[model samples]
Target: MAGANYTLEFGLEAATDDATIIARTVQEVDAALERVIAAASTFNHNPTAFVVERPRFGPLQFPDHGLKIDVDPRLGVAALAWVGPDFDCPWVTKSDRPVPGASLHKDIDSATPFPDDAAITLDQLRAAVHEFRESGGHRPKCVEWQEADGW
Candidate 1:
């Protein structure tokens, strides 16, 4: 079977409404990510993060499969949430000790606090997103993941 088709969901300060971009190819996903990074880097920080998820098939779906990427361009780091079968696991770049006062996706009113040890650098985010696109929406193994408590 082919991998699940995916979509990118995000918001932009320049736009009155949120944006959703369907991605059927790796290039498309990359382009979307680049667009996201650009938007995130804007002085206003319109969208600090975005989500990549598998679209629901007519009658089949895997709500557990997807990733939430929180980007801090100024810091050159990003946090990844593997919202898959194992639940909202945060990628860990170091020990389990959470980053002090870590909060993600600030543009959204209900941004969730993440227990991420340390957000990966922009370069790593690129690799992880690439792996995710290639894997057809499966959890990317490009980095280490530590399960969050109560997740």
Candidate 2:
């Protein structure tokens, strides 16, 4: 079966000119990516991997899977993109159908196939971090998906 492709892009605006938050947020994102990769490995034969190309400046790679995280501190934005074999795990795809799960399914409808664990996990982590930053008076903004070609 052909693998599915996905991408997630988002930005944040802090109340203050805190350059430190950039590094901190990047660290948090890296940790979250680790967790997602771990979860994906259980189900995917070729589990996605996390590789940081640069400390704070990223072009994080998930080798062989064409996955990468591109972050732009100037724009306060990060874009994650993946293109690889479809996750055939029972939890995610059963008989080529998606199983309903947590809030991750909110954006998906009955007709829409469920996204892989990696995508869900990444989205959740992003949302969580965004919320945390918001609580600290930082504004989460421009959460959107971009085409792989565009990224």
Candidate 3:
């Protein structure tokens, strides 16, 4: 939301409605759902009971916001939903394996405040993911680095 140059890119294969997707990406936000989805396994529910295919979103970038991020929140919701009970999609977070496990561990380490380490809240994770997504649009972090101020 910094500038008009905040370019949002979206990829839709089975999705024919790109406008709706874009709209949701920019305007709509649900704090309840957002807070509840604190991990990476909540998106794989097969309400159809036919087994849901794992979602694979590419590296998303927000150039103006300096936030490039991924979207996977199935695990946290599952935990919140069942606690000690068995979840329907045990293999949901298997989708997050490639970049989430080790990659996330390191990235979260770099982003968080320590001492209170190892305990990352939902908002923190959301912010980290948002930062990762919005860092690739067009605006580099230091726009004034090469400016001329008679220096």
lDDT of 1: 0.54
Q: Kindly list the per-residue Cα lDDT of model 3 for residues 1-151, writing each as its tens digit.
A: 3323222332211121212122123232233223224322332221111001212234762111122222334323111100001222211111222232221221232432111122233444444323222432322232111111110
Clashes by residue pair, model 2: 3-86
Worst ten-residue run, lDDT, model 1?
A: 42-51
Q: Which candidate comes out best when scored by TM-score?
A: 1
User: What is the Cα-based TM-score of model 2?
Assistant: 0.23
- Residue-wise lDDT of candidate 1 within 1-151, one digit each (tens)? 1355544443344332346665556677677677766666442333422235444534555344556656666655666666554444544333344445444452234544445575666777777776666665566677766664322
- Which parts of model 2 have CA positions greater than 4 angstroms off? 1-66, 87-151
Which sequence of candidate numbers ranks them by TM-score, best first? 1, 3, 2
lDDT of each: 0.54, 0.29, 0.23
Model 1, runs deviating above 4 Å: 1-17, 41-62, 86-108, 149-151
Number of clashes found in candidate 3: 23
Model 3 ranges with Cα > 4 A deviation: 1-20, 23-42, 45-119, 137-151
Report the CA-based lDDT of candidate 3 relative to the real structure: 0.23
